[model samples]
Target: MAQNRDDDANDGSNGTSNRTSGIINSGRRGLMQGAGLGAALSLLGGVSGAGGLISTAQAAEAAFPQHKKWKIVFVNHVTTNPFFVPTQYGIQDACAMFGMDYQWTGSATSDAGEMVRAVNSAIAAKADAIAVPIVDPNAFDKPIQAALDAGIPVFAYNADAPRGKSNPRLAYIGQDLYLSGYQMGERIASLVDSGMVALFIATPGQLNIQPRLDGASDAIKKSGKKIDIQTVATGATVNEELSKIKSFYLGHQDLKGMFAVDAGSTQGVAQVMKESGLPSKGVHGGGFDLLPQTIQLIHEGFLDFTIDQQPYVQGFYTVMEAFVFLASGGLVGPANINTGLKFVTKDTVEPYLNTSTRYEGKTTKPQIVPMKGAIKS
Candidate 1:
């Protein structure tokens, strides 16, 4: 008796056709069954003994097929900022790995209203998923809900809505902005002694940098030191930020230190300190991000330290969450992620200076570089 296809399906095995079936009456099939070792080897293209070709049905089931190519849209507050160069690379790498697509669009000047419009457009276009910075506390609330209502998943990255104010975005993937600033403030306290310290920011009330400014101010107040901290507003443009920093240095020659809460301002602080020879003047300075100039200045002792918030992973995990949600059909929920913050100073700036990779927003080519020494804490 010949076993049928239905019988093979119910057998709980590999679904190989049983030769005992009378339906396999062809002479070629009979010859393959008869010549045990040599014929089986030839049929299998190398294997010996009873091992031969699997049934067509079994082979089809064994193949691992590709998943649907889902598209994710990312809305940013600062669309052209260099700080997010690595973040874009992260999104690109993750999308390529998962066979997905992504779009980067947002306001160039951190306009909350513009970001809201982008969210609405994404919803209208029926995007698979969306990621946003949530830089405004109340601005994103309605738009995120609208996205959710449209059956599209949404996530937050780089920045998040304020605490105690509920925004409907799923998760955030960036540093604890306030905490990072508080810690930097403590460091500033140790370096400056009862003199004026200038804290520069590109945007004063913008959620992305405001919380950090608040944290730094709070930490300085908590220290109970006679430190006079002043917040200076640097314009959004890098050249404007640099000019402002230079002018500030010129006027506040007696200042004890300068620090910044944002990327462009941080680089400006480094440049001002270097040209003014502030370190030799016993004037300490530090700020956030690992801009190439910032790293070089830190190594040269022009600036004290700069924080690395792993911007690359912020984009990487945002896409990963979106992919999982689309693939698992909502069974896998997105979770908040904190991309780590690290202090890079003269002692630890070598690795950043030596490496030219996408992770650092340094280069476009992918590569693996050898480490020379044990990593420092």
Candidate 2:
């Protein structure tokens, strides 16, 4: 597994320039190896059984040349958040597969200034590529452009700049944040007829989540229901989010529903719902992410349904995109990827509660999970 480098003055460079000559040379070497083996195998009329399988695998490997262990820098808005544990695991798995390395560094408190500095650090380090969550619309534009100007491919993951806004990142790999929120809002409207409903957000204007909040509010407003939506700002940390959620519920005991746009606040919503026994009182609660506690609460009937944005794929696909761009020496164009959104209800939460795997950031041990039933779409 590749180790995650922290923010430090010493860049990970060991006398390597940002040149594609090494990659091209490696490709030529692989091509020679493939040509020699392919001609020999053809003369021998190929092998059979296990020998044939090994030969095929070797040929496939030869097709994709292995170059220098490229390093990609991932600048996140919340570096230590549990929601990204699986995301990091995805980064690790992808890096291992692609023979690459990555550094995970960013602000622990969603500080845009701090995140910008991290991006600057990565650019200065002469990283092979860079990925970041564009949490702040304008703050990342300059840094992304700078990275691109330095011959480093920059990608946006988890969050992207607002639509119609220009940002120089190559691609975005994450769920459709605004659409997911609108869909969740529709769910909320369906669950609650009319009353005061609270929506909590970790940060009010952050691009990563603010669109979700905006979408939810718009959906609720369009529902034409008498529901009163109150937007609450919960601090970045989990403990602070929990406290604020609890306090909100205490003051709005008569609220019809409670939901959140982010992971931590969603977990906090579930906790409050359970502690206050709000579900038994016909109060619906739900939010996003697959935090262990969130899954458990959903299974326990405390939360109606929590949305899954496939955080693991967000990291995995971003790395894959970066790898292709680097391996191709800028020939392969990276395209935007929507990770996807799925609502996890009580019926669908069983698997999540039963399994503890790196896919969900539950365990570090890697193993293929057995499937016993028909797959859900």
Candidate 3:
């Protein structure tokens, strides 16, 4: 599959908007009609499992069987990320526990074209359910439509399509990216003084992380601090990210804060900030997800905060939802599932240190810390 490599840095573009465009074949246009108005919904009853997100499926009246064997496809953005290790574990574990067959595949990066192909391949294999990270609003319209049209239940997990984009991806099973951004910005506000802030992202306008960048931008702007915001893109490589952060800082040494919207760039941002001898103020830093490195940076006092979108829940629930909906008669919309959000900081990172979080590294079972009240919101 061809890839679209765009610099996601907010240097020229504020990344406050999703500016991606691609043509959805006319035949598939109608599939993009499903959207929401934040209507009055009350599915609070009969909710079971983590975060009250299991289900109230039409099969709510019928007792759910303990064993179900269905095939599910999980299309992720960064398939190799350790942040996804637990997510994958969650999906695989849930599939085993629920008696479902699951396959995990996605591009190494947030390439919408690659993800669309993965979804199509899953459909071609006649998957019973599909879970995707709707990273590109324009790019995913057709494939998402195709899945739904094939009588397959598709759910958007982790990153969602831009709000009101008319993508037909059944329901969203991930964090409220923008709200997490707002919370990240709030934490940054507490750490940085009045000055310029650098917003680092992997690929702007891709799908999942852009909403978070936009959210954080809005919140930081709302803070009434004389903060000049600059967006910088880190091409999808760890060394590239480290170099980019170093370059941005070398060029603009006065930047007061650095906000990274992805995990890889978060660590880079912190490393560069530390090497530049910038305090948490002169270059206050915050980011998304908790990789071991990002957490280590936070402990070493290089990063002010990083949002935890509960990636494990994303992995666990995406499978659970797909499994339940496949067995049930209909879809599991807001009427059923909800992916949660949590912005983690120094005050909150301790509890997570020992919790069964989604940041399981290779060859390491997630360690649990039997404590609470460390990270701030």
Candidate 4:
């Protein structure tokens, strides 16, 4: 039977659909149904829109056809990563909205080898599409190419290809890492000219973060900010990372600022700065993502600012983009989605802090104001 997803989308928005007979079954939390090679591809061409079927409120209401069902596997770096929670929400909601099948599985710990294995497993399982964060450029080349050779559509999200145009993945969906880093660096250089400042990375070799360190260095040099930059490799565990940073700060009491690239490390970096009692001094700090704790730290004046990459949007759009590629027999790569690198200071953090959704890991109700009484955002 040909299925329509519109009703489910409407129901999701208005909270009303009761029918369980359609292709748009929001009730089916998670299920994988094998699709014929070509049958699965048909659903990717959503109705009446160049953007995927879930592009608008109306389009999202339509369902994936029973005959057009496709399964996708999202192999994330951190399955339990609070940062990707919004992204997971995006993937789950988008699939539910489109009536597609998807499974998100990955290494709980961030390991390139585990991610590659997960992608290979999905390929062996014959998933229609595979989305992954190719954080390590060299490590992912073979696995990504293999997925493409096997007819599974591969996409890079959250992280990007450092060596651009080198990988065969279909598309990338995330912030322009280098540019965002450049912007952050420009700001840091504007604040202070000469001092020993450090840029920290959670995974040293990971391409996404390394570029930020590069951008900061370039920007600092360009600004003529004789800033002594230290590129520190902090392991992912938050407390342990925080302890290492604190030890560094204690030894280098004359340090100026510390900029962080990864999400988990931001909070740790903020903590170390706060305890150092250098708020009045030239100790300024900034980080990449807006983890809840990071936002709270900013609000409390323990940190300067953090970035907002809009992870949910990243997850949602990447899947939808891959779906578009599959269903339309078209291709979607080099897709530009904003991470909304919002610089949240004490003044700006509070507005975003009231979010009910556990942005790093949970679902949320859209905050909507009725047209009759609404003031525009």
Estimate TM-scores for all models.
0.82, 0.86, 0.77, 0.80
The digit string of per-residue lDDT tens for model 3 on 315-339 reads 6777766755554556434232455
| Candidate 3 vs candidate 4, TM-score winner | 4
Clash counts per candidate, in order, are 2, 0, 16, 12
> lDDT tens digits, residues 1-377, model 1?
01121231222111111111221111211111223325433454332325664442222122213455667888887776778777877876666544567778877778889889999988998889989987877889899999999999999888888877788888888888899889999999888769899999998887778888999999998999999988999987778899899998899899999999998999999998888788998999899998788899998899999999998899888887886676567876678888977999888888899887878877765555777877666
Q: For candidate 4, lDDT tens digit of each residue in 137-233?
A: 6878898889888888888888878854488887788887887788889988987778898788877767767777777778888897588888887
- Which runs in model 4 stand beyond 4 Å of their true positions? 1-23, 26-67, 331-340, 358-377
Alpha-carbon deviation at 133 in model 4, angstroms: 0.9
lDDT per residue (tens digit) for residues 1-377 in model 2: 01122222012211112111221232221212224445534533333346544333233244455577788988888876778877877876666555567788888889999999999999998999999999988999898999999999999999999988999999999989999999999999999999999999999999889999988989999999999999999988888999999998888899999999999999999999999999999999999998878999999999999999988888888888887777667777698999998999999999999987778877766668899699997
Model 3 misplacement above 4 A: 1-68, 331-338, 354-377
RMSD of each: 16.6, 6.7, 11.1, 9.1
The numbered model that scores best in lDDT is 2
By lDDT rank, best first, the candidates go: 2, 1, 4, 3
